[model samples]
Target: MKTILNALAEPNRLQIVELLRDGPLTVGDITDKLRMNQPQVSKHLRVLNQSGVVEVQPIANRRYYKLRPEPFKELDTWVDSYKHLWNERFDRLEDYLHKVKRKEVDDE
Candidate 1:
């Protein structure tokens, strides 16, 4: 979890993960989409791979990158557990706004 979280902390790495959500991409494809140099892209990929958030597959000399998925699911589960806190706060705010509006309408 820490590894995945740390990997995702980097903005470029997050974009790379989002890109890999669709399908595997070669280094060239990633570089083109990100408009970054090969070395920089490769460095991001290395961190992602080390964290197990992404995997690399080589066909001939071209290597393709894909998201591992499980790490994201784990992160999602962790986030899901705390989501009700947001839901509760939003519900309270909504109720308050409704009452305030109703009071204003009645006064008017």
Candidate 2:
């Protein structure tokens, strides 16, 4: 989705998502791990949450953030649609390179 892509477009938010991949983390933990201030980390987390890339679980006082799989799975599916195109192009390129190498060897 556009919203999910836009949310991941920001470097900080992308990094936050990568961090969440390992497991759930509190805002403070994210801030400390990223070496960023609380407000900045919180803002990135808010964007990720809004885009449905991450979900939060509130345990009494602290909120822990974790990846919600679906958005990323959707992204993977979209990318897969173009996977064969890349493979075809790479195969063509490889064939051309092999021909060039054979020609050079013959010349030598």
Candidate 3:
């Protein structure tokens, strides 16, 4: 969880992480997607690499990045646990509204 939290700490890093959701991208591809320079992209990638949120592989002359997914899987599981709480609350509210509507019709 340390790596997951740290990886998501920065806005640029988060943007870069989200962009890599589809698949691996070269440095140039990620930079072009973000409208940033190569150096800036590398900086974010470095942080992600250190955090172990992403993996980098050198192919030919260029470096490519891919999402590690493990860290994000931890995050997803954490967030998913609270899903039912919101749904239950919304369901209650909907039932209450329908009851109120029926009461109004009866009074009319």
In order, what lDDT does every prediction score? 0.94, 0.95, 0.90
Cα lDDT of model 1 by residue, 1-108, tens digit: 898899999999999988888899998999999999999999999999999999999999999999987898899999999899999999999999999999999999
TM-score of every prediction relative to native: 0.81, 0.87, 0.76
RMSD from true fold, candidate 2: 1.6
Return the top candidate by TM-score.
2
Error of 2 at 49 (Å): 0.7
List model 2 lDDT by residue over 1-108, tens digit each: 899999999999999988988999999999999999999999888889989999999999999999999999999999999999999999999999999999999999
**Candidate 3 clash pair list:** none
Report the candidate with higher TM-score, 2 versus 3: 2
User: Higher-TM-score candidate among 1 and 3?
Assistant: 1
lDDT of 2: 0.95
Model 1 C-alpha lDDT versus the unseen true structure: 0.94
